[model samples]
Structure formats: structure tokens, C-alpha cells
Target: MKVLAIASAGGHWIQLLRLMPAFEQHEIIFASTRQSFSETVSSYKFYAVPDANRWNKFKLIYMGAAISRLVLAVKPDIVVTTGAAPGLMGLLAGKLFGAKTIWVDSIANVEKLSLSGRLALLFADRTYTQWEGLATPKVHYHGNVLS
Candidate 1:
């Protein structure tokens, strides 16, 4: 399976990386908003995308376009993210391309899902929360990066 793993920098990126072992048998492509993260994913195919947030509408649009193009080019079988905004863009693009999408809400958001996580629930094929209490009929809890 071809898997595209995407996330923003900092904790989001760390959370995504923690799940790397789960995709070890698959061909994985990594993406992050910060170029510095390239070093961490040096062993795998990686792409750098623009950092964006709800406060920056224009950048978000640009990121959406870039992610869309990347998703089309890679044509991954699955797209997964531990997100902020960039992850949302990837998930949206993945869904549009008919790739199965998984959204793993950041572990930091123990009380509630982040805004991007909630948005992902609208389209992501599978939505997960690290905290079991946060799981609902739609969102699931099957373990976490910390574990």
C-alpha cells in the first residue's frame, strides 16, 4: 500500500512520526510544513508544504492547491494525518482523489478535538482520538502515539 503521511510542524509532526511503525510495510510518503522536518523523514519520500491556519485564508488556499497537486501526482492508496491546517488540506485532497483518509487528532487535544480534527470528521474515512473518552460513534480510540 502507498501511504501519504502529513502533518504540521511541532507536536503534530511528532505525533505523525510516532505512527511510522504502523506503516513500516507500506510505501510511505511524508509531508510537513517545515523544511527542517525533512531530516527526520530523510529515509522516506518527503514533501514540504506551506504552513497555514484558519487565520490565514489565502495561505490555506495556496496550501490546498499544492496539496491537491501532490495528492494527484502521488496517487496514494491511503492518506493519514495528525493535524492542524496542512493535514486538513492533505485529507481534503486525498478524499477528492478517492484515497482512503485517516485523521488522528493531536494527542495534545485531550479535552476536545482540534478544529481541523472536527473538520476531518466530515470527510476522513476514519477519525481517531487519543483519549478514549473523546471517542464517539464516528470517532474511534484504538491506542495512541504515547503508547
Candidate 2:
């Protein structure tokens, strides 16, 4: 399977990395906010998209366009993210392009889903929370990267 894994920097990126073992057999393409972040996953394909947050509408728009282009070009069978803003953009593009989408909420958000996680529940094919207590009919808790 072709998997497009998207996430922002920091904890979101770290959480995504922790799940790399699960995708070992798949062809994985990664997207993040900075090229420096690529160093950690040097063995895999990586692309850098503009970084944006909920408060930055202009950057978010730019990121959305960039992510859309990447998604169309990569044409992945599945799109997965542990995210902030970039993941949401990937999910939106993946959904529009008919790719299955998975949203893994960051482990840091123990008390509640991140804003992106909540938004992902609207469209992501599968939504996961690290904390089992956060599971609901719409969100699931199978396992976590931390475990």
C-alpha cells in the first residue's frame, strides 16, 4: 500500500514517527513543515509543506494548496497523520482525492482531542485517541504509540 503520512513538527511529528513500525511493509511518503525534520527519517521519502496554525489563515490557505498538490501527485492509497494543521490539510486533500484517511490524535492530548482531531472526526475514515477514555462511537482507541 502507498501511504502518505503527514504531520507538523514537534510532538505531532514525534507521535507520527512512533508509528513507523506499523507501516514498515508499506511504501510511505512523509510530509512535514521543515526539511530539517526529514533528517530523522532519512531512509524514507519526505516532502516539506508550509507550516500553519489555526490562527494563521493565510499560511493555512497556502499549506492547503501545497498539500492538495502533493496529494494529487503522490496519489496515495491511504493518508495518515498525527497532527496540528498540516494533518488536517492532508486529510482534506486525501478525502477529496478518494484516499482513505486516518487521524491519530497526539499522545500529549490525554485529556481531550486536539482541535485537528475533532475536525478530523468529521471526515477521517478512522480516528484514534491514545487515551482509551477518549474513545467514543466516532473515535477509537485500539493502541497508542506510547505503549
Clashes of each: 0, 0
How do all models score by TM-score? 0.97, 0.97
Off by over 4 Å in 1: none
Off by over 4 Å in 2: none
Which residue pairs overlap in candidate 2's backbone?
none
Please give the lDDT score at residue 139 for candidate 1. Answer: 96
Which lDDT tens digits does candidate 1 get at residues 61-104? 99999999999999999999999899999999999999999999
lDDT of each: 0.94, 0.94
lDDT of 2 at 68: 100
Best by lDDT: 2
